[model samples]
Target: MKASATIAVARCGERDVVIDQRCSAPFSVRQCDGRILLASSAAAPVGGDELELTVDVGAGALVSVGSVAASMVWPGVGGESSSMTTTCAVGDAAHLDLSLEPTISLARSRHRTTTLVRLGSDATCRVLEETVLGRRDEVSGRLDLSLRVERDGRPILHHDERFGPDVPGAWSSVSVGAGRHVVSAVLVGIDPGPPEVCVEADRSAAWLPVAADAAVAMAVGPDRPSTMNMLAALHPALVRTAPVSKPRA
Candidate 1:
């Protein structure tokens, strides 16, 4: 089955957040503490499914989006594949946070995902993407992931990666080393930072400046907990510590 979900949010006042419009099936959106939570419903997606999502953050609004649970990718019975695409727009002085859950690819399964973000000159945004190869002692199927962000119509960040059986040594390559999972995080409109690498207990993570005001972090680990710990260690450096304030009148 194929599925799609869309969500739009805007600031009503100094601290009021509102949902402009939403459309979804097999996925549901809930609002809590000015953040939007997405979850799969009874008609959750399975093999051969396609999902799409669009998010719009109005001027002066502050919004965060996250999933309730990890999405499981199962192999198609007849050799089909699944795909997901997301598009986001952030207005002037707005803030958008995308803290998506991990994607677990089962044996022989195939999945693809793409995300595009457009931001205003003064907008602030943070994004996270994670993928786990497979269950215990199993090799993952395949995955193609891409993310792009542009501000004022100029490209600010672009990342694309492919992993799976089709790619030679996809799992055991130098890139992954001893890690079975990978996580990436990006921060825009932040202060510049020097490139550096940090290692902890069989995990390796790196942070590099992508633009004058943007940076990207990548980590690889043997399992979810370690990889996530690496991500947590790098978050404070990329994300702003101060709260988002309303745009000036």
Candidate 2:
């Protein structure tokens, strides 16, 4: 199956308003409490499925986006792989906050995700991605993720990562080591001051500046709570108030 969703928000006189919202099967969009919320109406991205979402913010507009629940990737028939792509564009002087819930990779499943962000001059944005290896007591499947950000037609960041039994060096000391959960985030138009690093027996996290007004943070831990805790310590504003809820059916 293939599906796509889109949303566009712009400043309307005195406040930000949704100018366009289109949803397809397995992808639902809603406006609530001054924020745009995304909800999956059906199981999706199973092996052989393709999905995509696009968000647009008009100049001078401020928009916040969140997900209603965590997404679970179920193994596709014959263990085929699936993919999802997210694209975001922020206009000059606009700000976009994308705080979606984590995605869980179930055993035998293979999934890939690509995120691309384009920013106009002076535009600001925050994007976060989190992953749980698998359900409790189960080995994780495979996941490949990539992120790219460009500001004013200039590239500022490009990152790629993969994890799972099939990924080379996924469990090596240079990677997550023995961790099962991972978090990655990027912030533009905000100076997080200086780099911060924290290392512990079972968990580690760091926030590093990548550009004049951009920063990236990464973390890994034995479990979800510990991993998110490490991220929250570095950028409290990016961490959600509540943890990602259990995966939907």
Q: Which stretches of candidate 2 lie over 4 Å from their true place?
A: 240-249
Count of clashes, each model = 0, 0
| lDDT of candidate 1 at residue 154, scale 0 to 100 | 91
In model 1, the Cα lDDT at residue 33 comes to 47
Per-residue accuracy of model 1 over 45-153 as CA lDDT, tens digit each: 4568888888888887877877888888887788788888889999998888887788887788888888898999799788878888887898887888898889999
Give the poorly placed runs of model 1, Cα more than 4 Å off.
Answer: 199-201, 238-249
Tens digits of per-residue lDDT, candidate 2, 93-187, equal 98878877888989999999899999999998888888888888887888888988899888877888887887877687777887778888888
Model 1: how far residue 201 lies from native, Å: 7.3
Cα shift from native, residue 98, model 1 (Å) = 0.2
What TM-score against the true fold does each predicted structure earn?
0.89, 0.92
